[model samples]
Target: MPTKTLRIPTTDGPADAFAAFPDDGKRHPGVLMYSDAFGRRPVLERMATELAGHGYYVLLPNLYHRHGPAPVTELPEYIGEEVRPAVLARLMPVLEAHTADRVLSDADAYLGFLTAQPEVCAGPVAVTGYCIGTLYALNTAAARPDAVAAVAGFHPGFVVTDAPDSPHRLIPGLAAEVHLGIAEGDVTPEIIGELTRALDAVGLGHTCEVYPGTVHGFTMADTDAFSAAGLKIHWDRLLSLLDRALARD
Candidate 1:
């Protein structure tokens, strides 16, 4: 796979992003990968490269580009449980600033850049996200129903909140096949039933599961909550969704 640093022109400005694609000259399906609140980092880049090797052009953009390029706020080389709260403190404000309006605006710009690429095939693409990043993926799928074919969210949050604008509300308009890997501690029988009922009501295609024994950040390698099994499960579910939704000749 070949990886490169690039810029996605947004309504805000040129947002710095990373891209990974197969070395072969042929174009492939496009996958937009959104990072956790940690924003872009080596872990995200490696994840993008691994996915690109599987025959898709994966693009990882800075979700907090409004403040600045990724690492929007400096982060520790390793984020352990002891420092997790402080990190979330610094990031929450920036993440909070990304209102739904801003997310939808940025999605249009990012999707335009992705679909316009010579290395990307002509068709609906996929969007994969982790942690709070899942909200971005959901918004993109809803706002650009024509351009997004699948959505994979790992340890997702805020999808079924009481807020009128919760991400689940966006499901009715989405054409994407959805997969949501919910962290164990984040859900109860009630939450699961609520979320599932919403999906069923819309007649949307989806797979929703609570990853057993995994905490909120189970898929993040640098966190104490990281679970090897959960990470592998995410990869399995995510790739399957992409393979089926973005299948091509």
Candidate 2:
């Protein structure tokens, strides 16, 4: 696989991103990969490379570009109890600033850039995200039903929030396969049930599962809650969803 650093022109500003794809010189399906609130870092780069190894052209953008370029703030090598609060303090404002409107705008630019790449095949693409990135992933899929074929969100925060513009509210617009991996400790059973009901109401093909005993950020190798077993489960579900959504084309 080969990886490259790239920039995308967005309505708000130029967004920095990373791309990884197979070296075969053959065009592959495009996939928009969103990074967690921690922003783009080594872990995200590794994940993008891993996805590209599966034969898709993976694009990982710096979602917090509105505030600053990635590594927006220095992330600790490891996110333990003592360092978690400080990191969140610096990250909260950027996360809050990523309103639905901003996400939709970036989505347009991102999807456009990905599809235009020489290594990407034509047709609908897929979107996948982790943690806070999951909200944007869901919104992007809904906003571009014609171009996004599937969406997968893992350990997402604010999925069941009371906010008027919560990502779950856009489910009706999604014309894609959806998969959600909820951390057991992130939300109550009732919340998950309500989200599932919303998905059903929209007639979207989807699956929602709770990864047992895992807390938020279970798939992030740098987090204290990281679970190797749970991460494996997440990868299995994500790759399966991508294969069904992008591989066919």
Q: What are the models' TM-scores? A: 0.97, 0.96
* Model 1: colliding residue pairs: none
Tens digits of per-residue lDDT for model 2, 4-119: 98889999889999999999979999999998888899888999999999989999999988878888887888888899999989999888888778999999999999999999
> Any runs in candidate 1 off by more than 4 Å, and if so which?
none
Best-fitting candidate, scored by lDDT:
2
The clash numbers for all candidates, in the given order, read 0, 0
Each prediction's whole-model lDDT (CA): 0.88, 0.90
